[model samples]
Target chain A: MAKALLLNPTAFEAGLVAAARARALSPAQSAALEAFSKTGLPHRRIEAWKWTDIRANLRDDLSSASAANDVIAPSIFGGLGAFEITIMNGAAEWSGEAPAGVTISCTPQGGPLSELASNHPLANLAFLNTDETIAINVAEGASVEKPLLIRRIAGGGAIHQRVTVKVGACSKVTIIESFDGVGRYFSNSVTEFSIESGASVERLVLQNGSDDGVETALCAVAAETMSKFHQTALLLGARIVRIESRIALGGEDAQADLRSASMLCGMRHADVTSQIDHRAKGCTTRQLHKSALKDKADGVFQGKFLVARGAQKTDARMSVNALLLSDFAEARHKPELEIYADDVECAHGSTVGALDDAALFYIKSRGLDDAAARALLTEAFLGEAFDAMPHPAIERTFRTRIARWLEAGK
Target chain B: MLKIEDLHVAVGGHEILKGLSLEVPAGEVHAVMGPNGSGKSTLSFTLAGREDYEVTAGDVTLEGENLLQLAANERAAKGVFLSFQNPMEIPGVATMNFIRTALNAQRKTRGEEEVSAADFLKLIREKGKLVGLSDEKLKRPFNVGFSGGEKKRMEMLQLALFQPRFVIMDETDSGLDIDALKMVGEVVNSLRAPDRGFLVITHYQRLLDYIKPDRVHILAAGRIVKSGGPELAAELEKSGYDQFIKAA
Candidate 1:
C-alpha cells in the first residue's frame, strides 16, 4: 500500500491512510487518496501553506471517530425563514420543505475533481473521506424568495465533508454556510459553486469554532457570462483555521465581490486566502479583507488576482488592512496582481498597524470609556466590509458577532 | 465655574505649563492669547485629563469638584468639553451616530436619561444646518473628507448639542473663515448661561470681534504674562507677540 511506501509520515498522516485502507474505497476516492498521498499534508515548507502549517498543528495520531450525537442548537440564521440543511461531522441530514424552485439530492460520491479541487491538498483530503456529497440545484430563471442555510456542526474527531451548489441560468439564490463545533476535532471541507449565465449567488460563510478545533474549508467557484458571485466570510479563529476560495471568471462581463473579516483573540489563529482568475473579457472584481487581532493571536490574508492574456478590460482591485490590538499580536498579509492583458486595470494594497491613538482619544474624550472606545474603534475598522450586506438582519447578525468578540476581549 | 491653581504640566518629561494659574467665573468668557509653543494647548489638554500630559503639580476644579481625579470620559461627563485644535478624521464612524452616542454616553454616565433616536436625528439636523453642514455631510464618517472649516463647524455642532457646563476652545478659530467664526460665536453665545463658563484660546482678535471676552490674558513661556480687557486682543494683534516673548 502507498501508506507503507511513503517515507516517514506523521502520526496524523498515517492515521488518515490507515482509515482509508480500512474502508471500501470508490475508484474516485482512491484516486483522490493517491493524489493526497503524494504531498501528505500541507506544512510550513509549502509556499501556499507557509503561514498556516496544518501538519504542525496535527502532530499526534488522531482517531477517525464517528459523528458525536450532541444535541444540535438552533442556528443563528433560524430567524431568516430559510430552508436549513444540517451536516454533523461527515454526515448530512435535512428534513424540511425545500425552498421554491430548488431541488436537493445526494450522491454516494461526487463526479471527477475540478481543476481547483485537484490542486488543493485539503480539498482532496475532504473528497477522499466524504461518502455523501450534498448537491443543491436551483431551477432556471427562478428567483427564490428564501435563503438556503447549511449548518455544519462537528465534535471530537477528524471529519471531512463535501457540498456542491448549482445555480441555473437567470436564477438568484442566497446561501449561508455556518460552521460551529465543540471539543477537539479536525474538519476539512470542500464546497463548489457552478453559476450559469446571468445567475446570481450570494454566499455567506460564518465560522465559530472551539478552542481545540482545527478546520480548513476551501470553496471553488465557476462563474459564467453575466453571472454575479458575491461572497462575505466572517472567520472567528479556532486553534488553527484557514478558509480559502478559488474563483474563475470564465465568461465575459461576469462580476465578483469578495469581502472577509477575521476577528481573532487569545492564542487562536486564522488565515483567509483567495485566488481569483480572470479568464474572460470585461470582467470586474473587487476584494477587501480586514482583520483585528488581540492578545497573542495571529491573523493572515493572502490574495492574488490574475488577468489572462485575452481577458482585456478586466478591472480588479484588492485591499487588505489589519489592526493589531496588542504588542504580541501579529498580522501578515500578501496581496498580489499578475496581469498579462495590456488593457486591464489591476491593483492591490496591504497595510498592518495598531489602532489610531488619536482616534481612540478623540472617542474617549467624547464620552466612551477606554474599553468602550476601543470596542467602537475596532468594530468600525472591521465593520466596513459588512456595510454592503443586502439584508439588514444578516448585517446586524454579523455585527453582533463582532460585538461579542469585542466584548470577550474586554 | 473653572479654576486652576499653580498647574504644572509636562509632556515627554519637558515642562510646558509652569505654575500657570487662571480662573473663569460662571457666565464669563476668558480669552488666552499666546504665540506658538506657549503652553496654550498643553493647558487645555491637561484640564481635559489627557493621559500623556503629566501633571507634576497643581489642582484643577470644575464646579468645586476635583477634575484632576477623573479620566477623560469621566471629566467629559462632569461637563468639561475641550474642542480639539485639530479634529480627527475617524473613518467608518458615522458622524451623526457617533455624536449621538457620545451625547447619550455622557448623559448616561451622569445618571441622566438618554435621548431618543428620533429626537437625536432632529437635533443633529437642526444643529448641522446651523453649522452649515448638509445632511449628506452628517451622514458620512466622522470628519472624513471634511474641510478644515467644516471640521470646526462640526465641533461647533457638538458644542451646541452637548451644552456642557465648562467649554475650552483650543485654537478653534485657527482654520475657520469669517462666517465660521461668526457661527462659533453664535453657538457659544447661545449656550451661555448663569452656570456655564467659556475659555476661548486664540492667537488673533478676529474671532473675538463676534464673541466679546470679559478678560484676555497673554500667555508666554508657560505662564500668563499679562491680563487686560478685550482690547488686549486688538492690541496684541497689532503689535504681535514679540514684546511678550521678550518679557517672558
Candidate 2:
C-alpha cells in the first residue's frame, strides 16, 4: 500500500492511471503520463507554484468522469461575427465554414508536446488526457477579414483539451478564446501558436469560472523573424485558476505584447504567469498585469524575461499592479529579468496597495457613495490595460465584463 | 444657513480646532482670513465630512439638519461642496463622465430626476466655457497633466456645476493669475443666490476684491479672533495676522 501510494499520491492521479490503462495510448501520451507521475500535483513546496498550491486545493477524485452536458451560454463576443469553434467537455465540435485562406481540422490523436510543455506538469496532464486535438491553419500571405472564436465551456468532473494554431508567413488573424464553466470541475488545457515570418496574431482571452471549478490553461508561442504576437486576457477567478504563457522569440525583430487583468472576490483565486525567452537580436516584448482583490480572494503574478547571450539589443518591460480593497485580500507578485547580453534593455516594476484615500474622498465629495466610489476607482484602475486593444467591439465586451464584476462587488 | 457651535476637532490625536464657533447666514458670502496653521483648512475639511477630521466635541447643522450624522457623500447630496486647495489629479477618470456621474448620483439621492446625457453634455459645455475651460480640455482625464491654474479652473467648473447650498473655498486663489482670479470671481458671482451661502477661506485679500464678501473674520490659534464687516478684510490684509496670533 505504501508503494502504491507513492506511485499515485492522489485519488485524481489514480483515476488518471486507470483511465489511461483502459485505452490504447500513443508513445507521447505514455511519456506525458510518466512525467506527470513524478509529481502528483504542484504544491506550495514547489518554487514556481508557491503562491498557487494546486495539490492542496484539489480533494475529490476529479478523474471519475467527464462533466455533464448542459446548455452553454452564448459567447459574449458573438457580435464579432467570427467563425466559431466550441470545445465542451474535452470534445471538439464545430459546424461553421472556415474563413478564407483558413483551414480547421481535428484529429483523434494529439501531436507531441513541445519543449515548453515537456517539463510542465499540468500541460503534460492535459496532453495525456485530451480526446482530440483541434488545428487552425491560415495560408501564407493571406489576411483573414473575420476573427476566429474558440469557446471552451466545461461542467463537472475532469476535462482536458488541446488546440494548435499556425499562422503562415505574412498572414494575419485575430483569435478570441473564452473560458466558461459551471459547477465543480477541473478543466486543464494546452494551446500552442506558431507564427511564421512577418505573420501577426492577436489573441484575446476571457476566463470566468464557477465558484467550485478549478482551471489551468498553458499557452506556448513560438515567433519567427519579424513575427508579431499580441495577447490580452481578463480573468475572474474561481476556486483556483491559473493561466500561464511561455513565448520564445526565435528570430530577429520579433515582437510580443502580453496584457492581463484579474478581479477576484470572496475565496476565489487567480494566477497569471509568463516566461518570455528572447533568443534572437532586436526582439521587443511588453507586458502589463493588473488585479483588484476583495474579501479573502488571492491574486498572483509571476513574470520573467530571459535575454540570451546572442540576443543583443533586446527591449522588454513589465509592470504589475494590484489593488487590495479589503484588509484580508492578498496579492503576491514576482517579476524578474535574467540577461546574459549586456546591451539589452529590460526592466520590471510591481506595486500593491489600497485605494488612495484622497482620491476616494474627492470622488465621494462629488456625491458617490462609498461602494460606488470604490467601484468607479477600481474600474478606472483596471481600464488602462484594455485601452490598446484594436477591436472596439471586443474592447467594449471586456469593459462590460469589468462593469459586471464591479456591480457584483458592490 | 450654516452654523458651528463650540466645535472641537482633532487630527492624528492632536487638537486642530479648539472650541471654534462661527456662523454664516443665508444670502451672504463670508471670508475667513488667517495665517498658516490657523485651522482654516481643517474647518473646511471637517465641514466637508472628511473622515480624518474627528469632531471631538461639536454641533454642525446645515439648514437645521445634523450634518455630523451623515457621511461625506450624504452631506454632498445635502448641497455641501468644497473646492480643494490642491485639486487631485485623478488619472484614467474622464472629466465629463465623472462629473455627470456625480451629478446624477446627487440628483438620485435627492429624489430628483437625472439629467440626460445630451442635456448634461450641453450644460457642461456651456458651463465649461463660463469657467474658461474649452471643449478640448473638458474631454481629457480629470485634472491629468493640468497646469495649476487649470486645476483651479476645474474646481471652479465643478463649483458652477454642482451649485451646492454651502460652498467652502480653501485657498482657491493661492495659485491663480489675474485672469484666472477674475474667472473665479465671475463664476462665484454668477452662482450667488439668496438661499445659498459661501465661506471663502484665503490668505490674501486679492480674491475678495472680485467677489465682495458681506463679512470677514480673522482666524488664529484655531478660533475666530475678530469679526467685522467686509472692510475688515482690507484691514487684516495690510496689518496681517501677527496681532491676532499674539492676542490668541
Candidate 3:
C-alpha cells in the first residue's frame, strides 16, 4: 500500500484505481497504479505541469471505457512498403512477413517500467495499463531497407500501448510511430528504444488526432558508444496532446538528434517537451522544434539539455521557433541548459512571433493572393525542420498535410 | 497607360500623398524625381494598392481600369507591377518554385492555362540570364542570402517573367553596380512596347542616363510641382529638389 496521500484523488483517479483492482495486475503494476493514484493527474500548481493542466483539461472519468475490437484505419505511410504493426485500442496485431533481420512479437507480461523515466509524472502510465508489450528487434549488423511502422489507433475511449524496440550493434533501421484517434478519447503510449554501439536508428512520429481527443506519447531512448539516434515528429494537435522525448546519451562519442514540429488549428492544444542528458564524454546533441498555430490553438515547448559532471567535449544546441498565425493563438516556450562540466559547449534559443508582413507582401506583389502568400511563407518557415528526414515519400506526406492545414485555416 | 487624379493617401493616420496627380501615357517612360519624404514610395505603393497606404481620396486608373478598387494581388493580375525599393528575403521558399507559383497564380486568376514546368524552367532560365542571375541563384531560396544588387536583379527577373502592362520601378537603381544598372537599362529597354507604360521613381539621374525617360516630373511634398521633357532630369540633378520643395 502507498503511504498517506498528501492530496485528494479525483473521481477519475478513484475510478482508475478501482479498475486496476478489478484486473489481474502484477505486483509491480499494482504498485505503479497506487503511485499514480496518489499523484492523480498533473495539475496547474505543479511547476512542470503549470502550463499544461492535464487534470483540468481531462474532464471525463476515463476509468471504464470499451477496450474491445477497434476499427483500424489504413496508414498514411502504407505505400512506402513499410513493415506494419498495428496496436488498436490496447490490442496488438501485425500482418505479412517481418522481413529479413527484423523480428516482431508480443510479450506475455512486463516487470517494471523504466526507473529513470518514472521520475516524472504521467511517465509510465502505459506500462501500468497495458497487459503486454509489443517488441521489435533488428538483428546485429543488418541494415533493414524498408521502414518499420507501428500504427496505434484509438476510439472514443481510454487506450494504452507499450512498445519496446532495439537496434543491435552495427545495424541501421528506421522506425515510424504513428498515433491516431477518433472522437473524444485518452490515448496513452510509451516506447522504449535501445541503440547499441556503431548502430544507427531513426524514429519518426506522425501524430494526427481527432477532434476533442487527448493523447500522450512518451519515448525513452538510450544511445550507447558510437551509436546515432535521430527522432523527428510532425504533430497536428487535438483537444490536448502532449509528446515527450526523453533521450540519454550513455556512452562515449554518442550522437543524438531530436527534432519536432507542430501545426495546430481550431481550439486544439499541443505540447512538445524534451529532455536530453549528456551523461558521457564527447557526446553531441542537436535539437530544433517549431510550432505554427492558428485559430485559438495553444502550443507549448519545454526543452532541457543537461551536461553531467566530467562529461567533457559535450556539444549540444537547441532552438525553438513558434509562429502565432491568429490573434487568439498562444505559444509558451521554456528552454533550459544545466552544464556542470566547464569544457562543454551548449546553447539554447527560442523565438515567437507572427508571419513576416514584408515577406507576405513581397510574395503578394509577385501575384500570389493573400492566402497563398501566407501559406507559402509559413511553409518556407517550416522548411528546415524536415531537411534531415529520410524517405522522400514520408516527407512529402507531411508537407501535404501542412498544406492542407494551411488551406483549411484560410 | 496609367492615370492618377488627385490621389490623396494617408499612412498611419498621417497624410503622405495629398492630392498628388500624374500621368504616364502609353509608349512613354516617365520619371518621378523627389527627395526624401516627398512620397515617391507612397505613390508607387498606393498605385499598387498596398493595404497600409490608405487612399483617403483618389482615382487611379490603369488603362481605364479602376486600380483603386482592387486588392494588391488583383492589381498585379491586372498587369500592375511595383518593384519594391527594399525587397524582402523569404527564406525556405525555393526561388524557382516561388516564381513559378506566382506566375501560375496570376494566370489562374486570369482564367488562363498554367505554363508547363518545362516551359517555365526555360522561361526562367532566359530571364535569369537577362538579369545576370545564374542557375545556382535560381535554385536558392527566394532572395535569401542574396546581396542588395542580387535582390534588384531578382526584381528584374520577375519583371521580365510577368511582363506587366504598367511598371513602377521604385528606386530599382538605388543599390546597383555599373553592370547591374546597365542590365536594368537593357531589361527595361528590351521590354519597351507601344501598348505598355513605365513609371520610374528615383532620386538620381544616373539611371536615367542608361534608359532616357520621355518625360520627367518633379514631385515635392506630396504632388508633382513641375513636369518637363528629358532635360528636366539633368536640370534637377544640378539644381537639386530645394527649388521644388520651396515651391510646393
Candidate 4:
C-alpha cells in the first residue's frame, strides 16, 4: 500500500476543504485556501495567538447550517438616527433613505487580502469564504454628518464577512459596528479602512456574543498624509473573542488613536490585540485599553508600536490598565515597541489591580453600598477608554452596555 | 444620639480597641483625645463599620437603632457620618456626580425622595461656599489633585451637605492651617443642632479651641481611662498621654 498521507486531517481542515469544493473559486480565493490549508487553525503555539487558542475553541465541523433567528432588535443608537447596514450571517441588507454623501453597494470582490496579513489563518479564511463584500465609500471632499452603523447580527453557524471602507481626501466619516450574535457560531471578519489625505475616520465597535460563540475581527487601516484614524471599542466578551487591529501610517503628520474597553464575567474570555506601524515621518499614535473582569474570566491586551528607519519624529504612547474584581480573574498585557528610527518618542504603561480599598471605603462612607462602590470604581476605570469616542450617542451606548454588565456582575 | 458600650475590636488578629466604652449625647460635641497607638483610628474605622476591623464584642447605636448590625452605608443612612483622617482621592469620578449619587443613595435607603439635579446643584454650591471651595474645585474628579487643606475642606463640604445626625471628625485638624481650622469650626458649628451630635477625635487641644466640646475623654490603649470637661483636653496637652497610658 502507498504510504498514507503523513498529516492527519482535522475536522476544520476537512470542513474547509469541503467548503472549497462546493464553490467556484476565484483566483484569490483559491490562493487564500491554498495558504490556509498549510496553516489550518491557529493554536496557542502561535505567538500572535498564544493567548487566544482559536484552534481548540473552534473545533466544530463546519457543515451547512440555517440562518440566525430573524428577530430584529432595535438599535441601541436608534435615537441618533444613524444609517443602518444590517449584515446577518454574511448576507447584507439595508433599507430606507441613504444619508447625504454616503454611498453603499454590494460587490462580488473588492480585492485580495493584504500582503502583510496573508499569513494570518483567520485573514485567509475570511478571504477564502467571502463571496459577497460590502463597500461603503465616502466621496472625495464630502462630509457626512450622521453616523453609519454596520450592525452585524448573526445566528448559529459559520460566517465570513469582508467590508471595505474608503474615506476620500478631505472627507470625514464616523462608522460604528456591533458584533452581536445568538447561539454557537464562528465568525471571521475582515474590515479594511483606507483613509486618504486630510480625512478623518472615527470607528467604534461593540462585541457581545453568546456564551458558546467564537469570533475574531481583523481591522487593517492605512492612513495617508494628515489623515486621522480614531477607533474605540467595548467588548463584553464571548466564549472566545479576539479583536485585533493592524494599522500603517503612510504619509507625514498622520495620527491614529485606538482605544478599547472590555468587561468579562463568568468563564468568558476576551483579547484585544493591536499592532501599529509608523512607516512615515511625523506620525503620532495613542492607544489606551482597559478591562474589568470578575469570576474566572480572563482579559488579554497586546500592543506593539513599530517605527521604521526613516520614520523619525514619531511620537506614540500606549497604556493598558485592568481592574480584577475577583481573586480568580486574570489579566495579561504585553506592550512592546520595535523602533529602528533614531529620533522617536514612545512610552507604554500597564497596571493590573483590584478596586482601590481607600476609594471603596470612601464611597461606602458616603452611603454607597459595596455593590455601588465596586460598580462605580469599575466604571471609573473602564469609562476613560471610551471618553474620546467621536460620537456622543456611541459613547452613551458604551456606557449603558458597561453599566448593564456591571449590574449583571453584581 | 450615639452610644457605644464595651467595644472590643481586633486588627490583623491583634486586639486594638480592647473594651472601649464611650457615649456622645445628642446636641453635644464629644472629643476623644489620646496619643499615638491609642487605637484612635481603629475606633473611628470600627465605628464606621470598616470590614477590616473586626468587632469581637460591642454594641453601637444611633438614636437607639442598632448601628453595629448595619453596613457602613446603612449606618450612614441611619444618620451617622465619619470625616476620615485622610480622605481618598478618587480619580475619574466626577466630584459633583459622586456627591449627588451618595446623597440620593442615602435618601433612597431611608425611603426618602431623591434630590433633583437643580436642587442638588443649588445645595452643593451653597455648601461649597461654606467650606471655602470654589465652583471650579467642585467640578473636578473627586478630590483628585487636591491639596491636604483642600481635601479637609471637601470633607467639611460633604459634612454641610449631608447634615447627618451623628458626625465623627477623626483628626480633622491635623493637616489644616489657622484659616482651614476656622473654616472647619464654622462648618461644624453651623450644622450643630438640637438633634445632632459630634464625636471629635484629636491629638492636641488646638481644635477644641474652635469647636468647643461638652465632654473630653482620654482614650489610652483602646479604653477611655478618664472623662471630664473641655479643661481635660488642656490638661492632657500640658502633661501628655504618659499619665493615662501608664494608668491603662
Error of 2 at A308 (Å): 0.8
| Candidate 2 vs 3: which has more lDDT | 2
Compare candidates 2 and 4 on TM-score and give the better one.
Answer: 2
**Clashes by residue pair, model 2:** none
How well is each residue in A1-410 modelled by candidate 4, as lDDT tens digits?
A: 11112165577666766777578878888877776776777889889899999988876675554556665467677787889998888899999866787789888877887644666679888877888889889999889998999988778788899999989999999998989877778888989888999999999898988788889999999889999999999998889999999999988999999999999998989999999999999999999999999999999999999999999999999999998988999999999999999999999999999888878988998999999999999898899997746677778888988888888762
The whole-model lDDT of each prediction reads 0.90, 0.90, 0.86, 0.89
**Fnat for the candidates in order:** 0.74, 0.80, 0.83, 0.81
Worst 10 residues of 4 chain A by lDDT: A1-10
**A200 Cα displacement, candidate 2 (Å):** 1.1
Interface RMSD of every candidate?
0.8, 0.7, 0.9, 0.7
The order by descending lDDT is: 2, 1, 4, 3
What is the DockQ of the complex in model 2? 0.85
Task: Please give the interface root mean square deviation for model 1, in Å.
Answer: 0.8
Per-residue lDDT tens digits for candidate 4, residues B1-248, read 78899999999999999898888989999999999999999999888888888999989888888888899899888888899999999878999999999999999999999999999999999999888999999999999999999999999999999989999999999989999999999888988899999999999999999999999999999899999999999998889889899999
TM-scores, all models, native as reference: 0.97, 0.97, 0.97, 0.97
Query: Per-prediction DockQ scores?
Result: 0.82, 0.85, 0.84, 0.84
- iRMS, candidate 3, in Å: value is 0.9
In the range B147-227, model 1's lDDT, one tens digit per residue, is: 999999989999888988999999999988888888998898898888999999998888899889999999999989999
* Alpha-carbon RMSD, candidate 4: 2.2
Residue B194 in model 2: lDDT = 96
lDDT tens digits by residue: candidate 3, A211-265: 6778888898888999999988999988889999888899899999988889998
